[model samples]
Target: LQQVQPQGEDVISGNVSLPKVNVRGVVSNLLRQRETKQGPERVGQTDSDVINLVSMLFDFILDDDNLPVPVKALLGRLQIPYLKLAIQDYSFFSRGGHPARKLLNELARAGIGLNEDADHLKKDMVFKKIQSTAQRILTEYEKEAVLFDELLHDFSQFMQTEVRRSQMIEQRTKAAEEGKAKAQLAEKTALETVRQRLDGKTVPEVVVRLLTDGWMGVLKLVFLKYGPESNNWLGAVKTIDHLLLSVAPTEDDAARKKLFNIVPILLKNLRQGLNSVSFNPF
Candidate 1:
């Protein structure tokens, strides 16, 4: 086909316009993509397709190409919402796994704004900036509503997964702790019963000697009292105190004499009570 050049300032002005070939080509491709369904055939889409159909249009409006390299670079930073939307759409429709991630990453790199120094700054500034930008977008660009909705849907899905994972991890950790606690309590109760049976003999003293006293004994007593129905908080406190007293800095001689006297009396009383027991004989 023959092309007619649009009349403008004379060619002598040394200015000429290109055929707009790239722009027109891109627009046609965009229309075609809209009509196409997700399938193996569409997997061959190129980087230029994404850039031309989306990023280039935004660039054309913003006159971004005329900006300094650093400024243009800043403008091209990734918008997470947009990238996530594109990723989710491609993943769901096209079943493009690694390719989708790569394409999304490239598009994100090309058209997103940045959060420079966000780590160093206070949160209020960041929050206010986001709110102001969103408000501006709402007022200025009603046509972009579909894009915003898609982005929000992607975010909602992400948050739902995040919440579920956190709940699952919390539940598993709680269950593990409860299991450990139950096992410890059972062991303590068994030990306490053995101590009670040998109370009048040297066995209780031997076990108490083995314990280092302080928090360990406190924990033991707490388990004994709170772990079983027969146990009470008061009993826990008394047990802790008794174990502590045995290891306290009091005069050693006085303490030993008291313990010795108490043990013998307890033993004698227990033996006499046993002797007085009546048995039925035929």
Candidate 2:
């Protein structure tokens, strides 16, 4: 019994390699030991079939490359316990929703994304929880089937909470990325508009700086808040056009009068736009 008892700590800690023990042989030996104690008639054909099936199931689990190494090792430690359960309750094979079977499935699912590196394993909460559950089973499990039910309930709750937290983080990250992209696009649109308006125009360096820097930011803000088709965006664009018209040379008296009218409104709009983006207009 001592020799066949699972050495889970060694496997989990990576202190030693997983011993190459024969699953069928181990099951047979344990069964023989039990038979000696409970009378020779206890071992039978049904028990032999159970042993073979349990061994095959374990073989498949151990050989699966998809499962993380730590997960496989921990599950391997449960061979004796699972074999006992299968032999005790033949319904374990027939029932799809069996507590023991569900527990194993949940454990495997949780381990799918787990990092197998030793340093990461130490910090992995899921792996720690699985290790705790396996340790509890190894130490406390006997003939009680309710143990699996309780463990499954607790593990499922933990997993659900973790999944929700992960979803919230993912959503926030995606929103931030989307916002950054929209802001970049808006800035590009604003710069293009400023360049098109200023092309071949002889304006003072201060006015050029205002349009290229502060006014461009205002346009981006307007586009972001009200969109390109909105009245607010159109108003901002008109302000830029008026500023350019006011600054251009005009000799006609009527045109000079129009320029005088445009100057005050242009200055007012420029003040408001600069103020909106917190641009200093000294």
Computed on alpha carbons, the lDDT of every model, listed in order, comes to 0.40, 0.82
Range of the 10 consecutive residues with the lowest summed lDDT in candidate 1: 5-14
Q: RMSD of each candidate?
A: 19.3, 3.1
lDDT minimum window of 10 residues, candidate 2:
1-10
The C-alpha TM-scores of every prediction are 0.26, 0.85
- Per-residue alpha-carbon lDDT of candidate 2 for residues 14-82, written as tens digits (9 for 90 to 100): 665443546566556666877878865445788788877887877877777888877887877777788
Error of 1 at 192 (Å): 1.6
lDDT of 1 by residue, 1-282 (tens): 013332222111213332233433443444466557643233235533543344543354235443323222222232222232342344322444443233333333332343323332223232233333333333343223354444344544554665587689899999999878886875675466445634554434534543322223443444544655544434443444454444445567988787665555444432332233321111
TM-score of structure candidate 1: 0.26
lDDT accuracy of residue 207 in candidate 2? 81
Task: Evaluate residue 144 in candidate 1 and report its C-alpha lDDT on the 0 to 100 scale.
Answer: 39
